[model samples]
Target chain A: MRVALADDGALFRDGLVMLLEAAGHEVVGCTADGDTLVELLATEPADVAVLDIRMPPEPDGGLSTAERLRADHPELGLLFLSHYAETHYLIRVLNIGTQAIGYRLKEKVGSVEVLSDTLTRIRDGEIVIEPVLAQRLVDRPSSNRRDMLATLSDRELDVLRLMSEGRSNAGIASLLFVAAKSIEKHISSIFMKLGLPSDAAEQHRRVLAVLTFLRSVQDSG
Target chain B: MTLDTYDATGSARRRADEHWSRRRDLERQLHDGPALRIAALTLRLGLLAQKARHDVGGLPHDIEELQYQLHLIQQELRAVADRIYPPLLHEAGLGPALRELASSASVRVDAGGGRFDPAVEGVVYFVIVGVLAALPPATRTVDVVIRRDADGLALDLGDVDTGQIGAVRDRVRWVDGVAEVGDGLIGTIRVRIPCE
Candidate 1:
């Protein structure tokens, strides 16, 4: 994958370049802030653009840049790295777009393996959320929400948590040590229980299920 | 007329002192926490890079320690960030932010939900936090009511320590708000800030 990036932090940017190179992805452009990254992207194209959520030109310049990138190059993948895992940032990232996008903690994505997998998942047009954020949404006591979330059994909740993390059926099966077929059954059951339409495409259904979970948590907060 | 002049000068001096004290605390927090950890991480990373070239087998444990240090830096930075301006205050608005604050507060907080002017929200939110922090350690429970009405926003705090009432009054008065404290063994503070 060809990647362009922006971050005001020189050290993190340099280390990220090293990590991406080690993972075998090409770093097409590196810049300090969103403005420079925008100028670089005009000529030096990339499959994905990694950005820091807080940077120069504005505190939330990365979010503004993502909006611009979405408008100019709708096909490009976006990954936001941040030091904090606040829901507000996640909501802002999701507001830009849900597909072909990811929001991961800066420390969590330092490893080559996680970085590579995150890039691949975004390129595949999946919504990848940080696992810590996913855990918060899932671990909120069931009694707090009187919606469809309460109907999910403990095992189903586990599957929902992994699904929110952008895990595929096979990936989830491998992690949970269950058969692929069983994973499929649990997912379909989840969709039905959540009132998601059966005819919708798998990707769309997954997004809807995740959206339901998030909205319930957001409203209750 | 002379008494009024003296009162004005006294208040001005107090404000200047408070401003200076806050700056000093901020500097101390930054220097003592994330700043020191980040400097240490730079050396550790340099060492790890060298080790990676020669001793790949020992790299995993070294990397784990680096991650732990990074985590601590993040936590420290979060405290600094909250003091500057809680991200939630601007991102999610005041109501949700207050609810989040309530979740972790030592005393129970019933923060009613409603959006107001951002500046007003900031003043009110911080005032509540300040008042809660000032309460006596032995004081266990206090009820906080934040409500919005046609006229303005009202905050009713119960069981405040008498010693902190004057400070609370000054903070609220800075925003052109009225704060009335009850006279009793345990006090209550009622504040009203009009919303335009």
Candidate 2:
């Protein structure tokens, strides 16, 4: 797969290039920060773009860049890497679309094997979130929200959990050993029980379910 | 003024919390983004070193030195990140954040409270941190109380040194709250912030 990366640190970016190239993936493009990354996409296209959430100096460097990339090239994949396990960022990126996106903590991305696997997953149209992120979302205080989340049947909740992790309908089906159509039915029921607007986009509704169940309790602070 | 004597509704309190929340959010972003990149780099370097050691011949001297340098960089970066904003500040609230601050301070400190508005909590944390940072090395035994009240929340820090009160007063003023600072070495500071 052709992969492009953007990070302000020269050493880290150089290491990533070596790591990706060593793993036999084509390093189609590289840029120092998100703005150049967006520009790189116009001419030197690649299958996916690995972005650092906060580039040097600018606090939220990659956020708008990814938003623009998603808007401009719907088929292009995105995988976000950051140091902290903050869910608000995850929600914003997931709301972009469930297709071809991945997020992992910088510290947790251990080896070329893991990064390559994630890229391959995204390339195959899966949402990839690091497990720590899922744990953080679960740990977020949901004092008033427990009942609503508890309404999901165990099997339904399993489907919602995988959906939140960026799994496709077919992917969830295979994981649960169910049919894709039943997974769709489970999702429709999840949405119906949550009282989401019927006309909302399917992707938006999926994100909404995840966001509702594991909404960042820290949004207040 | 006693907590109940003054009117407690003020727009600045809301605005202050918004500002502080944004500040904390920015700090967290730095912690998660750049801080983690260095960590990932360290891991990758370790992986490379492990490969050079086992799969290949003995580890290359150059790889060994590079690994040591990266380890130092990661540690220094982590320290810088923690000082920029301790994760406890956002996670555990003002009481824990302050305790973390006072961990190394020369003076003895006591602090506790119920949760309040994030902005109110932030002001309390930062003000106390600033105050403790300026306390005389000879100073000892400060007391702090933070609790929710009918109107909003009250924070009182006693036995404060006079020199640091200016910064504390400025922060209180920004929030449209009042800070009562005593005149002598054994001074007291009390603040009542509206819940707005």
DockQ top scorer: 1
Which 10-residue window in model 1 chain B sums to the lowest lDDT? Answer: B39-48
Tens digit per residue, CA lDDT, model 2, A141-196:
33344456667687877787787777779988999998899999999999987778
DockQ of all predictions against the true structure, Cα-based: 0.19, 0.12
CAPRI grade of model 1: incorrect
Once superposed on the true structure, which residue ranges of model 1 sit more than 4 Å away at CA?
Answer: A141-144, B1-58, B76-85, B90-93, B99-123, B126-191, B194-196
lDDT (tens digit, per residue) of candidate 1 on A1-221: 99999987776778788777877899999998999898889888789999988777675789999999989889899999876677667767888998999998776675666678899999889889999888876775222344567788888999999999989999999999999899999999999999999999998999888877676545544
- Angstrom error of the Cα, residue A25, model 1: value is 2.2
Quantify all predictions' global Cα lDDT against the true fold.
Answer: 0.74, 0.70
Give residue A45's error in model 1 in angstroms: 1.4
Lowest summed lDDT across 10 adjacent residues in model 2 chain A is found at A212-221
